[model samples]
Target: MAAVSLVSVSTVKPLGDRVFIKVNAAEEKTAGGLYLPDNAQEKPQVGEVVAVGDGKYKDDGNRVAMDVKVGDKVLYSKYAGTDIKLGTDEYILLSEKDILAVVS
Candidate 1:
C-alpha cells in the first residue's frame, strides 16, 4: 500500500485583487511609561504586505497591474480586511482599495 502525504499550509496567497498583510505588533506601553492592558490597546492599522493577487480584470478583458508588491509597508483602513490568525502570526486579507498608503 502506498502512503499519502499531507501538506500543511505555511504560506498564504491572496486572490482577485486581494492582498495579504502581516500586521505589526500593537503598542505595549503608553508614552508616559505606563503599561496598558490588552483591552486598552488599539487595533494596529499598519502592516507589511506579504502577498498580493493578480490585478482586477477590467470590462475590456484587460488585467490591471497591481500597485503594491511584496514587502511593501502599508497603512490600511482601521476596520478594513478580515483578520486571520495562522499559527503564531497575525494577518489580514483585504482588497487593494482598502490600503490607504504605502509608508516609506
Candidate 2:
C-alpha cells in the first residue's frame, strides 16, 4: 500500500530484494466534489520507488535482477510492507514479491 514519506531520498538504501517506496496519498475529495474525512479515506496502492536493493543473491551466488528501479511508479499489495517513519515522513520497505506491477 502507499504511504506518505518526507524522509530524505538519499538517506536510506534498501537491502536484499527490498525496495523503498514513497507512497501517494489517498484522495481527499471524491469525483463528485465531496470531501472525505481522514478516517474515510482508503489507502492508496500506488507509489514511487525511491530506492532498490542490489538484487538478492541466489544459492549459487548469482544475483537476481530487480525489475523496478528508482523513480518507477508501481502497484503493490496492500498490507504487504513494513511501515517505517524516518524523521517526519513515512515509508514502506517491501520485498519485490510484494510489488504486483510496475506502472507505465
TM-score of each: 0.89, 0.86
Backbone clashes in candidate 1 total 0
- When summed lDDT is taken over every stretch of 10 residues in candidate 1, the lowest stretch is 1-10
CA lDDT for candidate 1: 0.86
Pairing residues by index, what is the TM-score of model 2? 0.86
Q: Provide backbone clash counts, one per model.
A: 0, 1
Best by lDDT: 2
Least accurate 10 contiguous residues by lDDT in model 2: 1-10
Per-residue alpha-carbon lDDT of model 2 for 33-102, expressed as tens digits? Answer: 9999999998788999999999899999999999999999999999888877665566788999999999
Clashing pairs in 2: 6-89
